[model samples]
Target: MKIGYARVSTGLQNLNLQEDSLKKFGCDKIFTDHISGAKSHRPGLESAIEFVRSGDTIVVWRLDRLGRNMEDLIRIVNQLNERGIAFYSLQENISMDKASSTGQLMFHLFAAFAEFERNLILERSAAGREAARARGRFGGRPEKLSNDDLRLIKTLADSGTPIKSIAERWEVSRTTIYRYLGKLN
Candidate 1:
């Protein structure tokens, strides 16, 4: 059996392209998720892994769909291999099965390349951050609330102002208010 898995980073992205490719590849069943690959918990991926048997194969439209990074990809592939299942990536032309030595070598080579690619990205990012720092700039999103806003929130809360009212005045959730206060603790 060839069980397929399809994923998109967000709900706004369509899964049709992946699903169609899987169907065209004659997948017996295809599980899907509309969530970021960085997330560890994916119901569809979990289901597909659990559904496969010793002789079954797992297929994905692309290698990245299986994992967010090389470590994750290698881990999931290793788990499948340990379970006596084959893995295939349609776009990457990677096939790893129990009886194929060439396939095993290729999988390792691909994993090495993936790792190198990740390292390159990290290096580039670090260089870019350093350049920004040299110019007195920083990355990341700016804070939503300023110190003054926080002080006002603290004052209101200390004066017995309702959390809901404070949240409304600050245009934030009560949870956010608690979180900011929690930071001081």
Candidate 2:
């Protein structure tokens, strides 16, 4: 059996391209997800892995779609390899069962590149946060309550006033009050 896997990072992302490619390959089944690869809770990918069996082939548009990082890709590939399941990467034109030595080398090279890519992303994000902090913009969410309101809340709580009543008077939910109190704690 030939099974296909597809992934996109955002809910608004379209899956048509991957679906069309899988159909062209005559995949017996296809699993897809719009969840970011950084997250481990990809329902579609998990289901696809579970569905695979010995003698089955797993098809993917690219290796990166299989995981967010090198370790993840290697782990998943090892799992499939152990099961005697072949993998076919359409874009790379590589197959686990038939790959030449050079092909295998290139696959690992791609894994290294994926790791490099993730590191670059983290570096950029960290730099962005530092820049924001330098600009005196690093802080929690934009103010949801006025200073007076927060002071009133603190005072009410200090006086042994029930949090539920304070929340009611402030027109906020109990969860919101608790969240605010967490900052104080």
Best by TM-score: 1
Name the runs in model 2 displaced over 4 angstroms: 98-185
What TM-score quantifies how close candidate 2 is to the native fold?
0.56
Model 1, residue 166: C-alpha shift (Å): 36
Residue 109's lDDT in candidate 1: 79
Angstrom error of the Cα, residue 151, model 1: value is 31
Q: All models: lDDT?
A: 0.90, 0.83
Residue range 55-77, candidate 1, lDDT tens digits: 89999999999988887888888
Candidate topping lDDT: 1
Off by over 4 Å in 1: 114-185
TM-score, one value per model? 0.62, 0.56
Provide the lDDT at 114 for model 1: 77
